[model samples]
Target: MLKLVMMNDALRNGDAHLKNFGLVYDDVMRPRLSPVYDVLTTQVWFPQEVPALAMQKTDPRGTEKWLDQLELERLASLSHCHNVDIVQMQAQCREIALQSMATTLDECPKCPPRKALEHALKIIEGALPVPSSSAKT
Candidate 1:
C-alpha cells in the first residue's frame, strides 16, 4: 500500500483516491488489493491539481496536497512501516517509473501526447530521488 502511494507520487498521479482502489477475495476468502488501474498523470494537464487524499499525519486539515521527503517519512510512520521501507520503496518506484516512461516514450509517435509524456517523464525522473552509490552497494 505504501508502495502504491510512492508509485503514484513518482508518476504524478493526482487522481489516486480511495475510489481508485479495489479489493478482491481470494479462494480462501481473504481480502487482497486488486491490481491498480486508471493511473494518469493529471498533474501534466492540470498543473495546479493536488493529491486526491492527504497521506500526511501532520495535515489534520488535509491541506497538504503535495508530499515531500519528510512528509513521506511521516506517512510511513503513520502507516506502521519501518523508515527503511519507505526509503527503499522510493528508490524502487523511481526506477520503475523512469523505465516505464522511457519505454513508452520510445514507442510513442512524434505528437502532442508524446510531448506530454516526455514532460511527464521529466517531472517523474526529477521528483524522485535515486539511491546513493554507497546505499546501492
Candidate 2:
C-alpha cells in the first residue's frame, strides 16, 4: 500500500503524509491495510513573508530552482510522465472516502473498530475476486 501511494502521482505531488494512512486488524489479530483517509491535493504556497527571488529576465527559472531546492522529485516525475491512470486511481480513492464519510459512523458501540472495518471491507470486496482457475471443479 505504501508503494502504491508512493507511485501515485496525485499523492506524490504533496499529499502523502502520516495523516493519509491507517491500519486494520482481523478477528484473529492479523493487521492489514485500512481504508484510505484525508486524501487531498496540495500546492506549494509561497510564503508571504519571504521575498520573491530576482532572476535573469531571459532565463526566468525561479520555479524550477524552488522545486529542486525543495526536493520535489515526486511532483516532477508526475508532471513529466504519463500519470492519467494514477489520477484515475486517486479519483476512485476520493470517491471511496466520500462514500465512507457520508454513510459511516464515527463510533459504533456494538463492534467498535472491527465491525466498522468489516463494513468497509464489504464496500471494497468486489474489487478482489477469487481466482476462477483455483476454484474446485
Candidate 3:
C-alpha cells in the first residue's frame, strides 16, 4: 500500500497526496489500498512545488514537494509504520505504475517524438530511494 502510493506520487510528481489515496475493505473486512486514481501530471502545471501531503511528522522540506530521495525514504518508513526494504518496494511499485503511466502518456497527443514521454518516464523513475550518501541530513 505504501509502495503503491509512493509510486503513484512518483509518476504524478508528488501530486498523489493522502486524499488522492484510500483503501477499500473486503467482504471479510480486510483493508487494501484502493487502485491508483486521480494521478494527474501536475508536473506540467505546478512543476516541482509543495507536495499534497507531508512525508515526515514535521518536515518543512516536504513543503517544497520535490519528491527527492529523502522523501521517498520517509514515505517508505511511514508506509508500513516501519522501515521496509526500499529497493524491493520500489521495484514492486514501479512495475505496477510503469504500465499505467506508459499507456496514459502513450495516448497523449502532446507526447510526440516518443522520446519526450520516455524522458518524462525516466524522471519519474528516478523518484526512488535517496541513498544514504545523497539523502538529506
Candidate 4:
C-alpha cells in the first residue's frame, strides 16, 4: 500500500489523499484492496505541492521524504505490506512506473513531454528505498 501511494505520487505526480484510496468487499463478504484511482497530474498545476498523505516511517507523517533502506524495512515489517526485498521492489516499481506513464500517454493525448515522465520515474524508483539514478538530487 505504501508502494502504491508513493507510485501514484512518484510515477504520476498525483496527490492521493485518504479519500482517493479504499478497500472493496466482495459479495461473499470478503474484503480486498481496491484499484488506485483519482490519480492526476497534480504537479502540472501545483508543481511544488506535496501529496495530501505523505509516506513516512520514523519520519514526520506530513513530510514527503525519500525513503531509505531502514525506513522501508520498517514498512515491510508491517503485517499487510510489501516484502522486505528492497531490490526486487525497486525493479518492480520501475516497471510499474514506466507502464503507468505509457498508459497515461495512450489515454491522455495531451500529456507532457517524455523527459517530464522520466523525471517522475526517478521519484518512483527512488521511493523503493534504494539508490536509483532517477532520485531527486
Top candidate (TM-score): 1
Off by over 4 Å in 4: 12-14, 27-29, 60-62, 80-83, 103-137
Tell me the tens digit of each residue's lDDT in model 4 across 64-133: 6445566666767764575556555655666776678677657766665755665555555444444465
> How far out, in Å, is residue 16 in model 2?
2.4
- The residue-by-residue lDDT of candidate 1 on 29-123, one tens digit each, is 78888999988788889877778865654566768476777788877777788746566678888888888889988886775688789888878
Give the residue spans of candidate 2 off by over 4 A.
Answer: 7-9, 44-137
Candidate 3: global Cα-lDDT? 0.61
Model 2 TM-score is 0.28
Q: What CA root-mean-square deviation does each model show from the true structure? A: 2.6, 14.9, 6.0, 5.5
Q: Rate the local accuracy (lDDT) of all candidates.
A: 0.80, 0.38, 0.61, 0.61
Backbone clashes in model 4, listed as residue pairs = none
Against the correct fold, how does model 1 do in TM-score? 0.82
Would you estimate the TM-scores of all the predictions?
0.82, 0.28, 0.58, 0.61
Better of 1 and 3 by lDDT: 1
How many Å off is the CA of 43 in candidate 3?
0.7
The lDDT leader among the candidates is: 1
Model 2 is weakest, by summed lDDT over 10 consecutive residues, at 46-55
